[model samples]
Target: MRFLLVEDNAELGDAVVAWLSMEGHAVDHALTLAEAHDWLAVAEYDLMLLDVMLPDGDGRSFLRETRTAERLPVIVLTARSQVADRVDTLDLGADDYLTKPFDFAELEARCRAVLRRRGTPAPVVIPLGSALFDPSSGTLTQDGESQRLRNRELRLLEVFARNKGQILSKSHLLDRLFSQDAEVTENAIEVYVGRLRRRLQQAGVQIETVRGVGYRMTAP
Candidate 1:
């Protein structure tokens, strides 16, 4: 998934970004509220990890603005663990809360759960004929055998599963998969789609290709 990390502490920000990236998530880091706002104005993010105290402004204000215009999912990470603080943040539309000096594993789990809750109505354990697609681990399994996916493959499958029956155009897929990157050609999308298709087929899933539109995942 694509994530925005709004944190001011340089060391902490770098560590979080690296950890999330290693877990197959595309992460963009912003050190201040201004930078976060600028990025939010142009790009789309699956989830945001925000720090309450920012250098330029309070993250709560930013969260409020996002709530007014869009339904962006945010997880407030701050040192203040007071009940009032949590209630205020949740009232302002934060989906989850994590206090400072927390475990990174817990943060990762929360991120996955938040994004999955916002996704399409696919089962937590996706069943495709005899195969099962586990979103949590990004793994495909069949007859008790399983294999993990690469970052790009996992991302491509996540998009497909989220928009199950929709015909996603190549441009749209590229935009979601390679956000803020250089222009990606349709060929690149095709190649990745081909790879994902083969993997899914091995696990007994079916992905349909529309003549001139795009691709869609159909029930087995």
Candidate 2:
């Protein structure tokens, strides 16, 4: 997934970016609202980790303005820990709020929760034959065995499961699978698709190629 981190604290920014990147996500750090706007103009992001205070402007204002146009999921990261502060931020359209000096694990869990709530609603657990697919955690389990999926592979499966039967062109897959700044080739999609195909074979699912077009997920 691609994320935009709008923050000014150098130490915190570096740690957050490093942590998320290690999980195979593309992350962009913007120290100011001006830079955040620039990033938004250039690329799309699945989520935004925003700081309430910035060098140039208040992130709350940016969040308010952003709400007027897009439904970008935002989690406000700030030093304000008061109950009223959380309520006010939520009132301003923040999806979640994290107090400063937070554990990275909790932060990640909140991020996942916010995304699951904001995303196009998918089944909590989708059954593919004997395997159970959990979209929230991006895990596939069968009996007592769980398939460990790579980041890209998991994302590809999620897309297919959501759009199930609809034809997805290679270009569309490319856009969905990679960040705008990623140096990827169309062949990369084919590679991931192949990997997912093998994994899903036992789950009673098939990825059908649409000839000159792209691919679709089908079930017997």
- Provide the overall lDDT of each model, using Cα atoms, as 2-decimal numbers: 0.82, 0.85
lDDT of 2: 0.85
Q: After best superposition, candidate 1 residue 63: deviation in angstroms?
A: 1.9
Which numbered prediction scores highest in lDDT against the true structure?
Answer: 2
* Worst window of 10 by summed lDDT in candidate 1: 120-129
Name the regions of candidate 2 deviating beyond 4 angstroms: 21-26, 42-44, 82-84, 116-123, 136-138, 142-145
What does candidate 2's lDDT look like per residue over 114-207, in tens digits?
A: 8889873644777766687886676899877887777777777877877788999998877766655568898999899999888888878899
TM-score of each candidate structure, all chains considered together? 0.78, 0.81
* Residue 216 accuracy (lDDT) in model 1: 83
